[model samples]
Target chain A: MLTAILSGDTPRSRILTVLLLAVLVCLAAAPFLFPGVRALETAATICIFIVLVASYDLLLGYTGIVSFAHTMFFGLGAYGVALASTHLGRSWGALLVGTASGAVAAAVLALLIGLFSLRVRAIFFAMITLAVASAVAVLVSQLFEITGGEDGLTYQIPRALTPAFRFGELFGVNLNGRIINYYLVFAASLVLFLLLLRIVNSPFGRVLQAIRENDFRAEAIGYRVVWYRTAATCLSAAVAALAGSLYAIWLRYVGPDTTLSFEIMLDILLMVVIGGMGTMYGAVLGAVIFVLAQNYLQSLMGVAAGAAEGLPVLPLLLDPNRWLMWLGILFILSVYFFPTGIVGRLRSGR
Target chain B: MSPGGANSPRPRPQGGVRLAARPDAGAAGHDPPTEAALTTTLLATDGLTVRFGGHVAVDAVTCAFRAGELTAIVGPNGAGKTTYFNLISGQIAASAGRVSLMGEDITRLSVAERCRRGLGRAFQLTNLFPDLTVLENVRLVIQARERKGFGLLSTAASHSGITTAAEAVLDRVRLADRAGSKVSELSHGNQRKLEVAMLIALDPRVYMFDEPTAGMSVDEAPVVLDLIAELKHDSDRTILLVEHKMDVIRTLADRIIVLHNGALAADGPPAEVMASDVVQEAYMGKALEDV
Candidate 1:
């Protein structure tokens, strides 16, 4: 069953398998294990980001396509959910409608961008995506009446998925709609991740990898390079948008700062790289580690600073406010040590 | 056979019925009238040309390659041999011209479309998926040929037929043992052989080879040459080879088309083209002097 789920492309390393299992277990039991609102929120974010980063990997790692407009797709999903819920009222049907429309819209936009830019050089495609992404960001911010502008949209979901709806108590913990919602996100993310795994191990995925390796040779061998690339871009965009819908559902809010910010795009890139490029398991690890660090690293640094209060420069260096600097240093060290990202390093037995 | 204009009209036989009448027409120049009557043109270029800015790379060149023949395109450096191949293969768009396959115009087709239309090209430089294993490199070609490359959610391993076919191709090329090894790890000669293996897997009606034996050791060259020779046995497949070595051309090519400075300099059998004064002055002057 595991082989079928993974499409027979296993982690191929003992450590990677263990690490992946640990992530899966932690995510599966995030509510009971973490036992805090903050931890639950972080867990949900990790779940959504895992899907987002993995979709990006389908483009960047597997297809050798670099796209900066991923956050735009994510934002589109969030907006889709937000706008539908805002206008259509708080219902499951509204959420479904929003998610589907968002995905379709993102796919259409991606197809247009891909057809126009993918025929050019890779660098040109990158530049065009960057430009298109920033343009969409600006447009979203400018469309005040419909998009809620910079303030964004804070809309309600179905009452069953809200924190107010409580069924009972389990293990002295309140079994509320919030926990149910977390599981909903978890299930969707898992299914999406597994589907992505199946895709990367499919014949289509092999052709994408062949294109990544050598587009010229792939074309010569009778694969339509442009069509395959455009298809990949569309698929990646739709998945990213789906992740965005889940994010909006979790937060009960959708804003440019939360979903569409360039920072989120950069974070997705970092996660994909830090975990591993081509391996789907890398997305799980990358999202978990990066999200955990983003959430808890500051507190960890504060504790270290407290412990080193007597030390002069050590305390200053370990200050909680300098967490960004510490993250930068950690990124540099990881890149130096785990050049192929953490999953690649583990799988290679390095 | 006449050695002049490649575009000259010939009394083409209607179909398979006339070919059986003259079974001994295999030897070129033996029976010119019978050979012309029996030949079927598989690929033709009509005033095919390409220009790079101010330079006409492949000038107005018209050539027709018949089925059951291996034509070697020889030329001096920068004589547009590779450029002409590129134009036909749809790698480089022709500034103006028409390329036809099996009597159907395919000048505006994409590279993949052209390949799907039975135009298989092997690059002068080793163009391959270096990261993939040798078996995988050929498997992709076979998968593409089978139109199974678009199978999403269907695991590649599920297609046992593709693997079996790929293995058969590797066995033919003698790279069966190296099937699991990456293409990058293969020796240069083995890589070239893998290139031919991929082309064979493509199973195109027209085989376009651009220096298939370039940059190989003495022993490695013949493995590919032998494969090309083996491919020549198929009368249905039309083969066009761009080569620099005179001896290799003399041994393999049934007809020779010489290009000098982006123009057709001579077109004939190997002996006649080799002894032609125009070819000698344009391409083989230095080589003949060395001899």
Candidate 2:
């Protein structure tokens, strides 16, 4: 089974198999061990990003397509749920409607884009997506009544997920709304991740890899390259929207800044590359490492600053609040040293 | 002056069964006789022209590549042999003309569309998924045909049919042992062989090979030529070969179409075309020296 993880049955794949199992175990134990609301929230956020980054990997890594409109789809999903909760009455049925709306919108938009714009060369497609995404972001911000404009949308979440709805306690952790929501997010993320894993290992995934390696050759062999790529785009968009829906439900908020911003898109790209581009496990590893670093590095630096406050030797660089500064350093170092991201490097054993 | 003027022998219809024959068949005045008798022109081009800005790469090449025959397109450098192949296979768009496969106008179809309709091609510059293993290279092609190449739920390696078909093609190409090796790890000759393996996996009706033995060693060239020869006799497949080697051409080509400066210079049986003054003057001197 581990041999099926990557294309080759090498020692690296065995290591990867062990590593993946360990990561899964750690993720399963995270909420129980930490118990803090902040830690649980962070873990939930990581779960969301894992889906988002893995979906993006379907495009960039598997299909060798680069589109900047991924976050737009993600935003649409969040907005779908957010608007449903605000206007359709805060019910479980409304949440379902919201998630479905997001998925359908992403699929339709992705189909149109894939059919029309995929005819152009790769770099041009990226540019067109970038332009479209920016326009959508602006439009969402401008539609104040519908989308809440710059203030974004916030509404009462369904009562089932509120703190008052306590079922019981499990393993000393109170089985309340927050815990239920966390478990819900965890379960959904797990199922979606496995679905994506199945997709990447499927015959469809092999064709995608073939196209990624040499699209022209793939076309000559009788595989409709355009249709395959379009299918991939739609699939990735749908999954990204699912991630977005999860995000909206977790926070009970949907805003352009959180869900639709270009920063999130960049962050996804960073995660995919840092994790490993083509390897699905890379997405998992990258999300965990990146989310941890982005979320905790500031606090870790804060602790360091408190300890070394009087030391003049490390003054300006060790600022705890300057998170991006340290992240930039880590990103550059990873790219320089690992080059192929952590998974790629480890697989190659270089 | 006409494209068909090179071959004026109009092959007479043996049974007079012209049910689906086009009404304006002889409208061009100088129709090649070969088409008159054997109406099974599996693939053909009508004044297929391609222009690269100021330069005309392929200038109005009109010819029929019939079924169950091996026709070789030989020429000097820049004679549009590869360019002509590119146009027929839908690699590049024609400047002005039509490409028909099995009497269906396929000029607007993409490369994959053409392949699906049984037109297989092997490139001169070996093109394979470099990162994938040799078995994987063939498996992808096999998988493309069998699974409609969009099976999202099932694992690729789990399909016993796909693996069997891939292994069968690899065995035919004699690369069964190197099935686990990456395409980059294979020698150039083996890579070309792998391309043929993919072509065989497609089981295409009409085969178009563009310099299939381009970079092979002397020892390796004959094996490929022999494979082409074997394919020719084994199946009633229409083969369009573009080769520079005179020896391989002599051994395999049933008929020869010599291209000179984006136009058909000579087209006939190999012996007659080889003995012709036009082919001797333009292409034979350089091509024969190597043989």
Residue range with the least summed lDDT across 10 consecutive positions in model 1 chain A: A341-350
**TM-score: model 1 vs. ground truth:** 0.92
Please provide TM-scores computed only on chain A for all of the candidate models, following their numbering.
0.99, 0.94
Superposition error at A78 for model 1 (Å):
0.8
Write candidate 2's Cα lDDT for B100-148 as tens digits. 9988999999999998888999988899999999998999888776645
lDDT minimum window of 10 residues, candidate 2 chain B: B14-23
Q: For residues A1-350, write the lDDT of model 2, one tens digit per residue.
A: 54554333232566776777777776677667778788988888888899999999999999999999999999989999999999998889889999999999998899998999998999999998999899999999999999999999998777778777888877787778877787788889888987888898888999999999999999999999999999999999999999999999999999999999999999999999998898877888889889999889998988887788888966556778787899988989999988888889888877
Which parts of model 2 have CA positions greater than 4 angstroms off? A1-15, B1-38, B289-291
Worst 10 residues of 1 chain B by lDDT: B15-24
Which residue pairs in candidate 2 have backbone atoms (N, alpha carbon, C) closer than 3 angstroms, thus clashing?
A: B10-B33, B11-B33
DockQ of 1: 0.73
Candidate 2, TM-score vs. the true structure? Answer: 0.92
Question: What digit string (tens of lDDT, one per residue) describes model 1 on residues B107-166?
Answer: 999999999989999999889999889988998999999999889978998899999999
